[model samples]
Target: MVVGSDGFWRLLYPIHHAETIRQAAEKNNLDPLLIASIIRVESKFRAENVSKVGAVGLMQLMPETADWIAKESDIPYRGTVDLSDPETNIHMGSWYITSLIKQFKGNRAAAIAAYNAGPGRVSRWINEGVWDGTFETSEKIPVGETRHYIQRVFFSYEKYQQLYPNF
Candidate 1:
């Protein structure tokens, strides 16, 4: 298959947090590649990236979500700036993703789509029953930006799988 361009994943991921995220994902029995993909999709791998929607840091964690993650993971975090650290964000973010997996019954694709769009929206789609799992696999995502993001993360997942198949 003649691949297109390298894709929208050119931004630099923090080398420091790579190890941390790997460890956290391993501990959670989650795929570090998927976590990496989430970071890429969530914040384009910037440690201090902040979204206009009030999501902050590498994981693009919203304030409420960050607090929930902190509580659920029992991680010590004070202000929102702590999330600006790539390591902390990835730590919590990967755990949160794993939690969502449990919530969604290992449906990583649906959980990812919900993370990008929102549980309610995804739930609506799911209840509509017109969407099979393929609808969650990037190409069929409803929202335009989320559609691109889902595709990008899956592409990143493919790259990470090739790079670290054992993980």
Candidate 2:
């Protein structure tokens, strides 16, 4: 799926839940495209998809993480099964991403890395200078999975902007 209008549509079709994504982005003070990119990369807008590691829904949030976010944000507690709901998942995931962006001091690459790996590991890497928390230095990230995840998300993010220039 490269090089044509078909590829563009394939890449962006997952963002059909634009209303939910925009609502979550507005509530969290985030760019809707960023949330869309994350959803595209994480679950491809497949609400029923679950990662082998147990992330769920359009945003691919883990149950434990969703629980913590609910408690911390004072959102009502729903069972993990609700993570398969696109609305709930997007809201939770947007809040989590907003928090990560703040935790990483607005370094989006580091926040994306944290989303793939974990905030604690990303923090340690930053604090210890193991990685500089920039896309240019992404190769310095030790975890191969996280490294590629960051790259893929950013690549899709750029495409989302290009395809939807007015978005």
Candidate 3:
């Protein structure tokens, strides 16, 4: 009841796009908290942010990936420029996460790793016996960025769950 400014900001940051995140998660059959965690890690809820590698919006979707998802899902894509729009970006990103989850057979950690490292690479690592695609073994993920990414997302997810149980 007595949350300070810092705590309030922390709570607000992850839930800034609550409506869009909830809608996207529901449509994609994903946990809204997971989406919020990803948004927190990817863009800190900044809809206009763009990564150095051209990832755009709150979900940080790359242009080519967005186009491919649009083609695969038959969703009308207005091009990467629209990725700056929170609703469009959240929907597309949520769809992508669902697709990745399916590809990895519901292995959330592997799917999340793929989201950062690419499915092909994750599959290769699994096939080659490099990493077992489990959270416990994520430390062995060869890609440092992806390994840290998975940890960060999971950490944020835990925080979200704690801070907003209803999320």
Give the clashing residue pairs of candidate 1, or none: none
Per-prediction TM-score to the true structure, in the order listed? 0.83, 0.92, 0.93
Model 1 accuracy (lDDT, Cα): 0.74
Q: Model 3, 111: alpha-carbon shift in Å?
A: 0.4
Sequence-dependent TM-score of model 1: 0.83
Count clashing residue pairs per candidate: 0, 0, 0
Comparison by lDDT, 1 against 2, better one? 2
The Cα RMSD in angstroms, rounded to one decimal, for candidate 2 relative to the true structure is 2.1
Candidate 3: tens digits of C-alpha lDDT, residues 1-167: 35665477565555887888889889899999999999999998889999999899998999999999998885558998889988889999999999999999999999999999999999999999999999999999998999999999998898788788877
Q: Tens digits of per-residue lDDT for model 1 on 1-167?
A: 23343332323332236688779888889878788778876776778788988999988988898888887887778879898987778888888788877777888777777788776787677678634445344565667876776777787787767555665
Stretches > 4 Å off in candidate 1: 1-16, 135-138
Candidate 1: worst 10 consecutive residues by lDDT? Answer: 6-15
Evaluated at residue 81, the lDDT of candidate 3 is 83
| Residue 54 Cα positional deviation in candidate 2, in Å, after optimal superposition | 1.1
Q: Report how far off residue 162 is in candidate 1 (Å).
A: 1.7
Rank order (by lDDT, best first): 3, 2, 1
